[model samples]
Target chain A: MSYLAFQLKKVFKNKLTPVCLAILLLLMGTVLFMNVRTNPQFSLQAGAKSEIAYRQKEINRQQRLLKHDKQKSKTEVYHDTKAAIKQNQDAVKQDKQVQKAANKGNWRKAYTIMWQQKKQEQTISSNGQDLAGINSRINVEKKLQFFNYLHHEPLPYESQDMPVTGWQFLLQLNQQYLPYVFTLVALFLLTLLLTDSYHQKLDTAQLLPLEKNNLMISNTIAGIVLTLGSFLAINLVLFIVASLIYGTGSLAFPYIVGQYTGGRPLIECISTGSFIIKVIVLQVLTFIFEVVLVQFLARIFRDKLPALLIAILLVPGLNIATMIVEPLRKICAWLPMTYLNAVDIVSGNLGMNYQNVQLNYTSGLLTLCCSILIITIMILLSSYIKYKE
Target chain B: MLTVQNLSLKTRQPILHDFSYQFAPGQFYQIAAENGSGKTSFLRAVTDLIPASSGKVLLDGKPYAKNKRKLFFFESNEWLNVNLTSLDYLKFVKRQWHSNVDLDQELDLLGVREYVKVPIKKYSLGMKQKLIVAMYLVSGAEYYLMDEITNGLDEESRAILYERLNNEVTQRNKCIILTSHYSSEIKVNNLHRLVLHKQKMHEVKQ
Candidate 1:
């Protein structure tokens, strides 16, 4: 058998590896279950209703002042309630349930109706240099939905106060969070398969019949395959278990994808399956990059603990660097790690919120591809050199 | 046949310089050196674990690296995956080398036949060493580079290893170069000894 085959067998048979896998499953299950217990719609409704309440109070105060002061004209009272009325009119126009409830002046029901809309798309136009930014966000959504159809990936329904379904549980886990969770587990599995072994130099694998490059490549291939296999296996199990406990829900549910710059937000409703497919593809790309990255660290460090530490730190370090450090904000969008939270990148929020950085799904894909290629070259170059040197 | 032509290595200070040697089939050479004398470094360099500062290793006029399948280097006996069973290790080696060496018989020869299914971590020091020796015996490689494999073997197991080494030299016409020398090796026939002195290889009558 090939060394790769032997490694796969050994990894699966290894005692502690299985326990680690169980821990990952347990973690994912807990988080997913917790999300289901707390309806996300309630939070959205609460926030919107709170804003409306505050606005209504201002309007009442303005009316009371107008009644007491004969010197003040009715124009001032109308101006005070103008902003609140316009906001209410926009909410009512966007959602039918919101319109019905808003006619009765029920801000809470209107907020709930808006959040529970069958589909939600936001359109933002870009007239300046934001054209690329707009396209990138739209691409992420297109790719997400397109790939879902390609891969036949199922997605969960949006979180509401109704009976929670397995699909709904998955839906609540935004693209931003799933990538992190998947990458964390991917890093661990890659550590198990490559970096840890290379770090200790426990085996004279270079002595294997294959060439040094081929050996590293074989190990790389095995690590990626196993990591992906484990990732999918855990997700499949989670989905099935969720399905059993909370019904499969609808695969045909609508997913709202949007692009906004200066123009009205252009939002569209695509099948949930399509949107999830993009998430799966982005995740696969992240896994590939992650596998190569950890292996690169392993070959450089030639010791398990240090390489492992660096790999773990890398995930959050990139985020903290770009987000927390003010100087790095401008270039953060150009980094592959920024796309580590692919959903936010796909939705253009990573760049939109930063305003300083310009990132979209395309930029994310490019950065990831470049990183993988450069790291692969480094792996090949360092393969010919001594592990310690 | 295997030849090391002017093999030299240096880490910080010089360890080995102007090293050259040749070995033919049906012969065994014992290399003995003091601690930090570069016996282990020499083995590691030749096996490509550490790159040599200069010189090249060849087998029958071809670079040894390109034809790595013909040589087996057991760098360290202790640095093995203990999660694997003895049989699993043997089977893995067998598959890699395409060797038809009998697994059960090799285990029986080393008296570790009962623990083929047991994880190597649970084995006594002697047992793990026996497994290491068994892997080399079955590797089917023409040239063998074993570094300090006898560090933990018991007396009877040492005798078994010598017996296997003698068989490789005589019957199989294989070249076995092992680091360190023990008195028990005296029984082996057609054996040569080389000692490392002053950053060089020197042949000594044994």
Candidate 2:
């Protein structure tokens, strides 16, 4: 039998693999249940009502200031309160319109009303290059894109907040915090599998007639396959379950990826199917890099716990560091850890977040491939040196 | 022939000091040592599982590294991966050495056929011992360095093991060097007996 086959057998026979998978499935199930319970349609209605109530309260406060403050400058107070009431009244009017459309199950009309209000606000407010202005522009462009896309396609049975369709749910899960959770989980599983296959069995495996380096490489390959295979199976199950519960959503749904126009934001959109495929490709590359990294660390530390701890400190640790470190933010396009947020990169959210347009799909693919190649070379070189000595 | 020249092992104190010997094919040699005498350590040092303070082992006057597949050594059944089954281990060893030993015959001889398909973790001590013995026989290496392989074997299992080892050594021209505490229980014929005394090997006259 091939050595990889033997290693794979050993990995699957280990009880830890199944146990970790079970826990992961249970966590996903619970999160899905919670998401279904707090449906977004109801939340939108509730949110609009609250916003109208808050605006009414603010208007009442401003009216009291206009009437009771006799000692203050009367003309300035009158104009300020009048402007405040007008703004609050406009907001209240919009909120009521949104609430009415939401009740009628016509989200497209609500988005059109929102787009008109955003256009009015844009005309009144100066269009500057500030972060808030950029964000507002992006939001406006996104609303228009969604409104246009909805004109051709059927209305999304559910909002993005609580996506009922399979494709939307998958996209939502990736776009939100679930990618981070999955990355951490995959890292944890990789650490365990590598530690067991290499560090714990080094002594016994040394006695094998095969070259030590070949053994290490074979075991590493087996570990990656098992780690990826188990995750792939879990994801398949999730996709099937989600699709069965909710209708399988159209993959042609368009998402605003970025702004193509330089000075003023012109929205660039991609299909959901293409976006998801790119995300998976980038994520698989990232996962391979992580597996090699854990093996390399295990070889260096020569113990399971230290190797696992250090790997944790390196893979996800570096990802967290990039968010807080200013220098790292500027250089995120070159760093492999930045690509750990594959979904965000594909969606252009990470690029926008860092104000660095270079952290996109192409850059991420190059950076991850370079990182994996370099680390794999290092591992092989280290193994050779240790074998020779 | 497998040759050991100037091998020295030490942990806090010396275990083997410049111990040298030449093991030829078609012979069964036994090394007897008391508890804590580094019997397992010697076997480990020979396999290069533990780094020796000094010296090297050679097959046909060449470094063991060049012909690693020609020799097989497993210190004990404890080193086997408990997650794997007996068949997995047997096939692994066979492919590693590129051996042509019949796995079914070896399993039947070692009486491991009953639970060969079960994971090693669930096996009893005796069952694991049998499986290890079967692996060694199936390896078909030129030199076999075993460490107390019969520790948990029953009388029937011991008889089967001795018969197989004798045939492999005398008829097949294979070299067998094993360490054991109970030398008298080894019933193979024309066996070369050696004793570990003062961190060195000395031949014993039968």
Top candidate when judged by lDDT against the true structure: 2
Per-residue lDDT of A8-36 in model 2, one digit per residue for the tens? 88677878778877877787767667767
Residue B125 of candidate 1: its Cα lDDT?
A: 80
Q: Go through the candidates in order and give each one's C-alpha lDDT.
A: 0.69, 0.77
lDDT of candidate model 1 versus the reference: 0.69
Q: Which candidate ranks first by TM-score, i.e. highest?
A: 2
What TM-score does chain B get in every candidate?
A: 0.94, 0.95
Q: Model 2 over residues B89-143: C-alpha lDDT tens digits?
A: 8988899899998888888887789998898899988999898888888998888
Q: Once all C-alphas are superposed, what RMSD does model 2 give against the true structure?
A: 3.9
- DockQ value for model 1: 0.45
Query: Candidate 1, residues A1-389: lDDT per residue as tens digits?
Result: 67887777667766766676688788877876775566544443443565556656665765666567656545666566555556545544444454455556664554444433321332322233476776655644443443343234323223433324565456544453456666666676677667535423633676788767778777777887777787777767777887787687776755555544464344455665666666666667777788888888877777767777898788757776788888777888666677777656665556655763346666777888888899898888876555433
Estimate the TM-score of every prediction.
Answer: 0.79, 0.86
For the predicted complex of model 2, DockQ is: 0.57
